[model samples]
Each structure stands twice: as C-alpha cells, then as structure tokens.
Target: MHINPYGEDPVRFAVELAVDPPSSAADLVARCRAAGVTDVTGREVDLDDVRRFLDEWLGVVDAPDEAARADRLNALLAAASAYPRLTNHAGDGWHLHYRDPDLPLAGVLRALISVGTALHLAGRGMHRLGRCAVAECRRPFADVSRTGRQRYCSPACANRDAVRRHRARVS
Candidate 1:
C-alpha cells in the first residue's frame, strides 16, 4: 500500500518522454506503465493526443523564466485538472487523485504531468527543470540532485562536457 504522489516520478517520466519520445501509442503506454503509472491501463489512449500534450508540455520545459514556466503550466493545469478526490480502489491504499475518476490515459497523463510539474517546481525550486547545459545535448532534465545544480541530462553528458572543457583548456 504505497502512495504514489504525482511528484518526482511523474516529472522524471515527463522528462524522459520529452527527451526521447515514444514512437507509438503502445510504446507510450508501455513506458507509462513501466514508470508505475498503473491507472493508464484500461483507458483509451491515442498517439495523437499524447503527442499533442507533449508538444504543449514542452512549452513548460523550454520556458525561459519562472513566470513563463508558471504561465505554461497554468495552461496545462487549467485544461486538465479537476478537484482532488480520495479513493481506495482495489486496495491500492487511500491516496489523492487530482483528476476525474474515469479519465482516459491521455487525460490522466495530462493532469498528472501538469500537477506533478507544479508540485515539483513548488516543492523543490522553480529552476529545478531545464535543458542540458551541453550545447550539443540540449535535452530536458529534472534537477533532483542533492544540490539542485544539475546542468546535464545525465552523467554521460556531464562527463563528456567536462572532458571537452579539459581538451579546450589544453588546446
């Protein structure tokens, strides 16, 4: 009976999907399920809907300032969110859901991502999300590091950039 709040996991999932988008509807569902978004099952999900949501969600990821990010997230929240409710369906434990009870997969993802992003930025820091600092690898990332100073999408990118800087210094 673990509670899965729409926080870090959903934000990381959003970053993963944004950085390396799924190739198909099935792939999207599979990735969501793999991420423990179990409610995605038993719902109608269309590739186009997911793509549209991701396209709009990228607006939030790429926003240049906190205000812009808030604005973009507000749009998503407005479109997707509803009143919070509690349920214990299938003995999954009592938890809050920020969407309607019967939302489809795409709707669930939209609400999850919007609310999750808001919660993450609010609970963490507004600047906790961004693109990788490496010029050639501007993939999106959620900076959940201890210092919240993550600049690269992953350690590989960080190491690559570090080595590149060292070569530049020697040259």
Candidate 2:
C-alpha cells in the first residue's frame, strides 16, 4: 500500500508488540490502528491471537544468534497458512499481502508478521533490529537511526545505563 516507510513501521510495530502486549481487544485494535493496521475487526479473539503471536515473535527477536534467528523465523514462515499475494487496502495503493480472508487469527498473524519481518530485514538493514542496551530491560527494538548505530531503547534508558556504567567504572 502506501508503504509509509515500511521498513520502519513494521519493525517498530513488531517491537512494540513484543514489549507490552495489549490488554484487551480494544487495546489491541487501538494499538494496531495507531500502527496503520486498518480495518481491525475489534474482536477479543484477535487480541488473544495477537498476544500469542507477539510471544512467538519475540522468540524470533531474542534468538541468540543469526542461525538461531533463522531457525525461529523459518518455523514461523513454515507454519503460516497464507500465501503471499499482492493487494491493496484502504487508501493505499497496491502492495504485498501475505494473507487470505478466513485465515485463523494466529495464522493470519503468522503470515503478516513473517512477511513484514522479512521485508523489514531485507529492505532495511539486517542489523536494524536489536535488544535494548539496558541490562535490566531485555526489550527488543528496531534501529531506525540515521547513523545505524543505535544501541539504546530510548534516551532515558541510555542515560541511565551510562550513569550505571560510569558508576561501575568509578567504583
């Protein structure tokens, strides 16, 4: 569709989903709506499915190494029920859609998430995604930095980590 910086949006949405899953169907729909997921069905099952999807998706994000990463992601792709297709929705023009109607909620997510993650890594840089540098917070992130060297989840986290490191060095 519009591709509103597809590389960034999908990765960011994936990371966000991984960090804190939505509490309810409305919350899930709202979060997805904010992330450009148009036409959310506003159903409780969708939220539950997405929660499951995110937990599995986080495993993809947290895989220890590249090979492990591929293994986890490959499992998802293999299990996905939807075949890749080109379609457009809402006001967006033509783009890829890796799903078909009537797909189960989890299956739908497996397709969308797998395809989206593939596009994000291939189109963007493979190194664009990572975990936060803060030791206490293992949250994952998509590095959309212009310099391509972002190591922290947020400035606050960075600052706190820096202070911790400085204190450690001084001690």
Candidate 2: the clashing residue pairs are none
Give per-residue CA lDDT, model 2, range 1-171, as digits (tens). Answer: 155333466667778877887787667667767877664563235666777778787887777776777777778777773665666654557766667755644555567677677667666666666888888886788777888898888888999999998999999
- State the C-alpha lDDT per candidate: 0.88, 0.71
Model 2 reaches what TM-score against the true structure?
0.82
The C-alpha local distance difference test score for the whole of candidate 2 amounts to: 0.71
Instruction: Provide C-alpha RMSD values for all models, in order.
Output: 1.2, 2.7
Worst 10 residues of 1 by lDDT: 87-96
Off by over 4 Å in 1: none
TM-scores for the candidates? 0.95, 0.82
Q: Which lDDT tens digits does candidate 1 get at residues 1-171?
A: 565678899999888888788898789889998998877767897778878898898888899899999999999999999999887765757888889988888899999989999999999999999888999889989989989898999999999999999999999
Error of 2 at 93 (Å): 3.6
